[model samples]
Target: MMELQKASNGIFHDAAVEGGIPPEEEKFLQHKDDGSKRPEFTDFEGKTSFGMSVFNLSNAIMGSGILGLSYAMSNTGIVLFLILLTCIACLSCYSIHLLLRSAGVIGIRAYEQLGLRAFGQPGKILAAIVITLHNIGAMSSYLFIVKYELPLVIQAFLGLTSASEDWFMNGNYLIIIVTICIILPLATMKHLGYLGYTSGFSLSCMVFFLSAVIYKKFNISCPLETYGNHSVSTVTSDDTCTPKYFTVNQETAYTIPILAFAFVCHPEVLPIYTELRNPTKRRMQNIGNVSILGMFTMYFFTAIFGYLTFFGYTEAELLHTYSKVNPLDKLILCVRLAVLVAVTLTVPVVLFPIRRALLQLLFPGKSFHWVRHIAIAVCLLFAVNLLVIFVPNIRDIFGISGATTAPTLIFILPGLFYIRIVPKTQEPMSSRPKIQAACFSALGFIFMIMSLTFIGIDWMSGEMRSLGGH
Candidate 1:
């Protein structure tokens, strides 16, 4: 290990001599504070203030999931959606708090650390695979959204016709596109610390999308029957003889997974925490509260308004509703364009960490060339698979993500690791706090099992059943 470190340092020095850090920070420059303090006090950019941290957290949680939430709500009803959203929030806070506290005490970085801390190398490998798999589904879904939507936004803005898909058919060309899209922004980023500004821009775009939808719905008519109740839309069309609306039972249960995906964002939190202005439990809690509350409001309004507008007519891609609006007001058009831009920005935020983790695993040394090539290859493979093999069903995506990976990453590993590895004194001290942590861990474990069971069963069955057709 020491010899490997010496060799890595030689390469780093040579790179530092050749080129400066991309645009953000100087490449291969070491901070004076790095070795002096603990690894927790490593060279984290001091960019995350209290408000900014919350916003970063909120943006991380509120990506492509928001687009499909109303449909999920349509499957489940208003009251149940609210109930599930609350449950998801509670479960999310539980994991964040427990994990943050564990990190504070034990200095864990990756989820693999949690597993290794509890079990051993086997545990580390298991956690890494599960989390990586979950992220793959998530990253693929985001890439598909960007690939399909971005070209339209570009055409709309530039007033050009849509381009043909001939180029993407070539694997090398597709990889080149995916690689450039991902690497341009990420390669420039010195660390995750500086992502706050990008997240802020994304948050503004999200706010615009929400406000535009609300404005569009401000004057629309609704039946007296539909006014007070939070129910799914029930409209029939000539294309489909039958109109489908959610039965309350299915709607409520369906929100369980939707909310699970919405609030499921722990992978980015730890790295962000290291950059906090003041890394304390209180600071973390404050960030969680403000950020999640903002998200709830944004998601709640979008769900209600989206359901009100499209109702039974909603498609697998909910954004398709924008094109159907008769007037297609300039304001809505601008907002749609903005949303497309924001989502394009959002996909890279998630992709960077996954790519980074893989690089660390494969190269184990600072080979930027190797890292870039791997990133390009993975993104291209993902783009091709999504375009060819996968159907854009949010339920299927959620089920696959939640069932196979979410449980292991969010609940099982955290709970088990905390209980087993982080030893607690049998002595009488702070009983209430201990009890609370134990309870939270227990609930996380239960949710983990449910996610695994539901997702696992769905994958086995291979059916996409919705309230309307199935």
Candidate 2:
């Protein structure tokens, strides 16, 4: 059985077949200079294990989104949030099924190519644009973390007060420095396959982060609030620690988008599938399911513990709230460093997709060039750093990207691709699969409009308050 599996999936040059051409090398098949020439699937093999694939996919799922979930939980209440979360997770898993099914019928593994195969140039362009925007948002949010936490981490390490007026204390300047010194160099590397292993390490860091949040919940007292310069704790008998089961407000609209943003791992699914040894649909689907489930547990615990720690006082970025306990505390400081390192290292990997999407958009049918690669990375970092420096809050990034980009990738594109790519002979238009695909795409549109309306209302409310104050 092992030998047969190896012969089929391993490197072969005889003919185009499953498991031979990796998604990455799909570039070779793109060369179309001669009309009579048929593209060949280059000989390639994948060595990613089921366990490593799960970790990598989960690493993709869990990101800057976790930091804001407690705030989401705060607005939506515990019960409603869990219900929403469970539904979203399941929908995301189903979305992966749609993608795999689409890719299987036609041996197109790249997301944009699936789009192209499904609906021609427009579809491919749409997929590229959505992936670009989604990844740009991801990179911006990761840098946003750098902007928010790095300065604080620096101050803590130096044992400086919040009043310290040093240039290193400024987040804007520090983000620029870090981008040049760390993120840019890493992003310029030729091959990022080695960086895949960092996913496991990054996952471990978040686990440590979860552990710390849980520890603080029990070890720290209630009514913890930061005054002008110090933390003040007042234990009162009447202070309630009860969790809210349901909540409503303008801010509640951000919850779904945030959840969507957190679960936007669909882009990584096909590439991982192409890299699996046996590469069965069920095998890859199981990997995705386990990855999403693992992340779901971690996110729920982090939000719950962080929310319980501060309750109504929970901020959009969960890590920021911790400094109130003591920015200089040894444990908190270490967690900050771990998070900072994980995100910084991740910036390069995250940047890889965005650059690839840009290549498909701008330089199609062209071979690799160092100039394009380096220019995109530099330009991306420059633009993202500006966004991090100028953006008012990370929540805005989560809300906007989740509403628009997340749904496009997670729901709309997959559904449309499945409907178009899968043959009518295999599944009629009236079949359950096709019906579900249509409904799923429609749901994405509905989610977009609903989220936008609520966010617009929230914005108007804030504007009115400002005008009234003036």
Candidate 3:
């Protein structure tokens, strides 16, 4: 054991040297602040301010997932949607609190590290796999937005007639160019601390999107025209314009998973917590509250206005509902551009956690290495771009990813870690923490099963439709 520890320290020293860890700080990278030999805290320090950390985290939570939320609302109706959204938001905040509390008790700053302290090697690997898969799904969603929306923006800007057949209008080609020119550079960054400005900008763009939805909801008369048909419209009288207050069916089960996806900043939480200046469990929890609350407000308004505007007619992607509106309308066009840019900037933020998870799993004791970092970023972005190009349905990706990974990250893991790490003396099986953990885990399991069931039913139905068409 002693010899193995020394070997791991040696690897850390070498990686730190290559990655530019200051020589004086190199010793700090070999052990914890408590003078323990744990590899978790070696060389990591918090540099992000409270406000900036909130912005980064909120950016992480808010992604292309918001676009599908109106659809989720459509399934659940206005009243149930708000109820579920509020419940999910509260549960998300509570789970994050559990994680931060566990990390505080253990003095660990990384999710995999927390897993390591909790369940040894297997736990670490599980955490890493979950983070990698979840973030990859998230990155794909962002790219999906880029792939679908960028071409429309280009066509609008160029004033291209529908008859025009320009190569530049191709979504696949545009995604490649955008990935190479924009996403690649952002994703290759070695630290999350440097992304604060971009994250803030991304949040601002989302706010613009929310504002646009509200403006159009009131300004545009209903019933809105379907895409490509100005002559025919879904007329909404004042009476019919009011949203359905409550409804439930098989579709309602799917909304839970979509709400889970909307609030999934869990993978990115630990990394941000690590970089937060004056970090403490309480401070980190505050950041989580501010971020989640801000997003909750934005999400609620966006969904309400969007659902009210089109009511029963809201599409899966809220932006698509606007297709019938004059594509050349400057305000609507600006909203699309804002959403595109928001999701574009979000790709790098989501990419950071996946890269960290990969490094923690593959090179456990190593410090940051630019070559490895850039290579991983490039490869991950390439893979996600491919999914965006080929995967025609973002909804399926969102459903599966949210169903499988979000619940684990949000509910199961946090609850499990708290149960494992909190001392038996402090938190016995009958204690509130343990009880909460048990309930949270149970809820997560149930959620996962239901979400998968709904997704399976939807998939089979889709297949039958395709066959029927053939």
Q: Which candidate is the best by TM-score?
A: 3
Give the per-residue Cα lDDT of candidate 3 at 467.
7
Expressed as tens digits, the lDDT of each residue in 1-470 for candidate 2 is 01112224322221122223334334433432232432221222446688777866777787766777888898899999999989999999999999977765554456776777677778778888888777777777677778878887887778777637778888788889999998898788754444567778888898998999999899765577564666544445463456788989867765776676578788777656655655666777899899989989998999899899888777777777776666657888888888887777767767766776676667664555778779999999988887788778655555566567777888899999989877776678999999999999999998778767766776877741110000
Scored against the true structure, residue 133 in model 3 reaches a CA lDDT of 83
lDDT of 1 at 385: 53
> Per-residue lDDT tens digits of candidate 3, residues 1-470?
11112222222221122122233333433333342333333335666899889989999988776877787787788888889899989998999988877775655567887787678778889999989888887777667667767887888887875634677878888888989998888887766867888899989988989988988887776666544544435554565556777878766665677786678899889889877776667788999999999999999989888888877677777887776665557888898899888888888898888988888888866755779989999999888878887877655655576678877898899999989876676668999879988899889998788777776786878641100000
lDDT tens string, model 1, 354-464?
654554344433444645644554563455355433454554644545554665556656656556544455312255645565666666567667656655555677855
**How does model 1 score by TM-score?**
0.72
RMSD of each: 9.1, 7.2, 6.2
Q: For model 2, state the Cα shift of residue 331 in Å.
A: 1.9
Higher-TM-score candidate of 1 and 2: 2
In candidate 3, stretches whose alpha carbon ends up further than 4 angstroms from where it belongs are: 1-43, 225-239, 390-399, 463-470
Native-to-model Cα distance after best TM-score fit, residue 185 in candidate 2, in Å: 4.0
TM-score, every prediction: 0.72, 0.82, 0.86
lDDT of each: 0.56, 0.73, 0.75
